[model samples]
Each structure stands twice: as structure tokens, then as C-alpha cells.
Target: MSTEFHKLLFEISEALVTDELAALKFLSLDHVPRRKLEAIHEPKAFLEVLQEKDMIGAGNLFFLKELLYRIHRIDLLTAHLGSSREEMERELQVLGRAQVSAYRQLLYGIAEDLTSEDVRSVKFLLQKQLPKTKLQENASMLQVFLEMEINGIIKEDNLTMLKDILQRFRADIKKKIDAYEEKKKENYSREEVRYPVSVSVYPEEQGAEGEAAKQHGKIYKMKNNPHGYCLILNNHIFRNPRYNREGTLQDGEAVKRVFKWLQFETVEYMDLEGKKIYETIKEYSKKDHRNMDCFVCFIFSHGEKDKIKGVDDECVNIDDLVSCFTGTNCPSLAGKPKVFIIQACQGSVRHPSVAVESDCSGPLEVDASPLTSIPDKADILIGMATVEDYLSYRSRRTGSVYIQSLCEKMELLCPQREDLAAILTEVNNEVAKRELEGSKQMPKITSTLLKKLIFEVPQ
Candidate 1:
């Protein structure tokens, strides 16, 4: 490694705490032996072992970047690695690119998502399986998982104990494990079926040209490794507890999952201030997208007519956010697709984050508030959660109905390369069918897109 690169690793190593090192070890178990990882006491030693095994280096830093991303250390990525969360996410989509196993990532993600109380519950469930020392209060979830693996309780192919425990409190996280297992089984079945494999003389050339040229003749080009930045501005908490958008984080997660699957560099900014939202949007607009295809943004927060409210209760006009991507303002993305999905209420009748409807039997859901329109900029599309005078619904447990429903539709339809309009149309229909507070929410899709904006994901 170069001296500079060595210095970078040194800095990163110094930054990692003990718990993060445990996470790094657990995630890297597939590559590094269990016995080897257990002996590694510090970040520097662990990284050195990785370097010795050629898992990370100056030429191949993907694994290194992934480790930081796995531990939710985007600051290290930006400051030291000269990369961002968006950049790493885009890179992660490349075929066979990820060093960490999906099973391991899923476990680590669940561990991070769990609260202290949740961890205690998990430990209580595992008390009989592991020793007293391993299930202590001071023991982190990652450490508990290590104990499970050591005791032959859960493995790469067997996560029943973990799944059963998680399903009690976090069905969503448990569902992830189930999905992974299902996909694994599917892959096995496909391999056993013996599908035909065509071998072209110039496979690389044809594959590249075929993907780039097959955009239905007259549509926006969507042939980049990363289609574009899928920026998510989710404000879940405010200074005042009353204004907290409880389920907004779930919306951000849903958007990030779908867009990243579509091969976009998904970057999420949480609980941004009124001024910060504008700054973040403008910052992305200022980025050079010469190598990108389209830009997608999801702003899920509270707001009023033609405006969005930041965590600090500051208001930013919908037009101002859209203007940042105007042809003149953002020249690089001039003719490219710019999509903005807003999840908030629009009318003066502000919807409480959680509400107990008097007419209804239960206090089932809360709501987010907004209505928005783009400027006269061609190729810009805005999908508002609700129409000009209605409240949008959000779940304290799940997420906003608009965004979650949209992401579900995108995942279902995008495999066939569905256009943005078709996807949003499906979203509108799906969300419209639901009755919140015994009323309906009609999502508005304002489009100036001259050509169809289809997203072609990584193979």
C-alpha cells in the first residue's frame, strides 16, 4: 500500500470504537476465519489481518468502503476515503462486488436497528442457548451473535433461532431473513433446472451496446452504472415531541431500499433543519452528473400548501426545491429525468402524526402533511402524497402510505424496465384504494418529462 493509503487506514482505525470492531469482525467472518477474528483485539490489528489476506487495498478498496458502510460510518467514508454513502451504495450494486455475505449483513443490520430493550429481550430468549457471561447486560448484540455461532446455534444456512426471536418484536427485520432464504432457495432451484446459457463471440461488447441501445427508441437514456442519486430527506423528529414524524424513518428506509436496488446511489439526510434541506438539495444538484442518467429525490416531512416544514419548523417552498434542478440551474442534468416524491399534507387542515378518529373504532394511524408542483422545467416530475386539500397517512410502525406503496410498486414493475410514469400510476392507484380516516388520498403526479424515464438496473 502507498504511504498515504496506510495513513488513511491508520486514521480510520483510530476512529473505530470497540463495538464497531465487533461488527466488522462478524460481517467479515466469511472471509476471515472465526478463530482469527476472535484474536484480533483492536481495529488496527483487524485491518492489518485484512490487508495481509488481500481483502482490502489501494487498488481494491470496495471491501474497506463496505465495512464502513456496514457499520454506518459515512463520515469516515466522506472525510478519509474521499467517498460518500451515495458513492458506496452505487458501487455495492455491481455483480459479485460485495465482500460481506447477505446473511451476515442482515444480522448486523437487525442488530443495529434494535433498541437496548429489544437487545435485552433477545438476550433473555438466548439465555438457555448461551452461557451467562455471553448474555450479560454489557454484551452487545454482535457479541451475542458471535456466541450463537460459536455454540452451533445459527449459521449461514440456518437462522431459525434468530428469526423466531426477531419475529416477536420486529416482524420487518425477521421478514428480511425470510426473503434472503427464499432468494437463496430460488437461486439453487434455478441452477438445478439447467437453464440455457448463450455464449456470444463478443459478449462484453454486445452486452454494453444492447443495454444502452434498447431504450425503446425515444426515451431518456438510462445506461449508467448508477442511474443517479436517489436523495431522501426524511425528517422524523423535531425539537418539539408533538411535531415528530414518527414513521418518516421507515419511509426513508423503503425509498433507499428500492432505489438502491434500481442501481441508484441512495443518500439519506435525516432530521434536517429548514435551511439544511435546501442546502442538501442544492449540493446534490451542484454535483456533476455527466456520467449519470436520472435523479430521484424523496422528501417526507410535515408541511402546508406549496411548502415543506423542516424539523425546526422552518418552511421551504416546493418551487424552490424543484428550481434547483432547472435546466439552467443544473446544466449537467438539463435533459435528464428529475423525480421528486413528496410525502406530506397540503391543506390548512394539518394532520396529526398520530390521531384517534372519533368516528372510527381505533387510533390506527397518524399522518404527514403537503402539496407541491415543479417549475416549468422539462423532464422534471413531482409526485405528491396527497392532492391540494387533503392529509396524507403515515404509520408509527411502518411508514408513509405514499412512499411505502410507491417503493413496493417500483420493485414489482422495474424488473421489466417500467417507465417512471407507469410506476407512479400504479402507486397512485394503490394508494387511492386505501381509505384513511374513512377518506381517500389521491396522489398527484405532475410530469414535464418529454420522454419515458425507465430505470435499467444492474444485472
Candidate 2:
């Protein structure tokens, strides 16, 4: 082995044998040469102690051995100093399988009141050395090297090796981020402004007008906007597995029930005769190009992550529907906000009964296909019924848990709030608290909003 490699190994082994923390500090700061040690008032205190013990040798091995002995005494003095055992263990776990473990073991063994910041500083030292060690190893050496490699450290023959590795890593990450932005630009190049919104209501399934009336009041209050036009799409087809399929209500009847309760400037009941849901969204997206500031797509159907079933029993990919409004096709709304509110199950079943007392009730389901591709420049906000792998509820009595809370918040909260992000944060907190009460399903929102959205409807 080369003298440099041998010296490095001896220093590491001696440090490991000594107080690991001191060893880590020494190695991390490049051995802190003897001249630098003179700055301290007790410069030769450690060396004099070692000499009294009659242990002295020339070169690396002798000095390393004496240093290790001094470190051992220091370790004895500092033990019994930090927090509880559990907190120490958690910090160690975060450090993972690295050279830092040896130092942590020594530190925790001595201290009873060690602060988290202290532990982090020690870990940071080990993290810095990982890359330098990785680059110097041969293939055989590399295989046996046990130290975890720190990201962005590389071995090189040139003097500027460390600087080169850092620059390379930064450039690589930047390239990936830039590509993402370019794709977003290509997707929304049409118009610079657009407006889109989705409105959905599940009217009384049967003789439940009283419950529907309360929900209608909430929806009515939700619809009173001071800006932006509203396009409401109502789902009227009812198919109960318990009853004969042929006896279910027709489209006209379902539409009439919906119209009896809510009002909008342009309200259209989904024509579930034989057409696909994607086709319907595509048709509507093209209408009235004059009022494009944002885009809203509301879905009220049985859905899984990426798929939602239509009223006519056809399943559609949620991505297929969302693609129609991409920046590439709908330029008017490019870089504007695009919102999707889905009321569906991403999974198959609801949670079984629990003993805890609660008022919120719903199935634990996840939408199988939610938004797969999100635009970076354009603002996209997705509000789902539950977290991934849980059921969302649609009660025979109450409509949807998310919709109810959303409408209530819009009326009671939005009227008073100016910042949409703050409003949504409140909505997240409210839904989380309420849904956990009666059901296991909790509402969630994933957003990459580019600009602030204010829902004031134009008079």
C-alpha cells in the first residue's frame, strides 16, 4: 500500500480506539497539527501526561497510540451527561450505518444532558469525510470499505478534486429541475389567463328531502361568488345494487331532483345515455373561450386513484380527462390555477368497525388514479376524499364528507378570508378533525399553486 493510504488507515484505527468523538473531531478538521495545538494555554498538558506514563515513539503510530490513551481518559470524564436513553437511540438511528456510529456510541455513553444540536454536529463531521474516502479506494478496497459514502464526494488525482465533485452534483440536480420547468412550459403555451371550477351535489337518493335541504342551504351559500363564472354539472343517475337495475331513476328525473334544490347560470346534468365522461369534459372545455382565467373539474362518482366510473357504468382515466385542459391545448388558462375535487374511492373497501366513539362516518378508500402529471408553472390543487389507501364516504343521509366541509368552509370562511392558501390550510385542519370523528377517512390536498386565487364572482 502507498504511504499516504497506510498513514490514513493508521490514523483512523487509532481514532477508533481512542475517544471516538475526539477522533471524529480530529479527522474532520484534518488532524489539527501540533503547531495549531499551541494556541491553547495548556498546550503540552496532554503530551506531558502521556510522557509521564513513558509512552513515546516517532512517526504516526506512537503519537496515535498516546492520543488514543488521552481520549480514553476524556471519555471517562464526560460519561453520564445527556438526555434519556430513548432520545439518544433515535438520534443514532438517524445517523444510520456510518463511521459516525462509533463517535455517537462514545458520546451517549458519557453524557446525560447532551443537546440535539451537539449530536448533529458530531454526525456532520462524519458526513463530511465520506466522499473523500470513496474516491481513493481500489475495486477490492471499495468492496470491503464499510464507511457509508456521503453524497457528492469523489476521488480524483487533481488538487481540485473536492471542488469538481461539488460542482458536478449541483449541475446534475439543476438540469433535472430545469427539464421539469421546460415540460410545464410546453404543456400550457396557449393563453396566459383562464378560469375553471367544478360544482357537484348528490341530491336526496329517495325520501330524504330534509337532509338534502340542509345540504342545499350549504351549497347555496357556497355558490354566492363575487367573481368568475360558475359551471355546475349534476349527476342524476342512481343505481342501487339492492334494487332491480331497470327500476332506477332516468336522467331527466335525476336532473329535475337536482334543479329543485340548487341554481346556477349554466347547469347541465351529465348525459349518461352512452357517452364517456372524458368526452363530456372535452366538449365542455371547448365552450365559451371568452371567460378563461382558471379551470375547475369536480367529479362526483365511484373512483379509485386514476379511474372514475361514469353514470353509464363506463370507467374513465382521470389523466385522460385532465389532459384536455393542459397548457398545450388550453393556452388561455396556461400557468393559471387548475383545481380538481374528486369524491371517490382510491381503493376497494371501507374500514371495519372500531370501538372508539365518533360522529364522522365513511368508508376508508383512495382514488386509484388521481392527478398523475402535475404542471409546474400552472397552479394545480387536488382535494381528495381520503389519504391514499383509505375509503371516502357517501352517506344515504349526508352527501359527501369532503363536499359538506368544503361548502361550509367556503360560505363561513372564504367570505372573510383573502388568501386562498390560508383558507385551504383551515379546510385541511377542519376536514382532518371532523372526518376522524365518525370515519377513518380523512381529506387531503396536494398543491403546486403558482399564484394566489381569490374566488370573488364578478357581478
Q: How many backbone clashes does candidate 1 have?
A: 6
* lDDT digits (tens) for residues 1-459 of candidate 2: 256534544444433422343333332222244344333233234333323322222321223332333345333222322233343345334311122223322222323222344333323444555554433423121111123222323221121332233234334433433454464465455322222221233433334434443334222123332112233334445343321122112322332332223232334445242245665676655554324445555666655556666555556776666665555334445455666666666665555433321112224245344565654325667777666566665544445556665655655554443445556667668766763335666767777775555554322
lDDT of each: 0.79, 0.43
Q: What does candidate 1's lDDT look like per residue over 91-161, in tens digits?
A: 77753456677878888887888999999999999878899988988999888888898899998899998
Off by over 4 Å in 1: 1-215, 350-375
lDDT of 1 at 452: 81
Evaluated with lDDT, which candidate comes out highest?
1
Compared with the true structure, the alpha-carbon lDDT of candidate 2 equals: 0.43
The estimated TM-scores of all candidates read 0.50, 0.42
Q: Candidate 2, which ten residues in sequence have the lowest lDDT sum?
A: 137-146
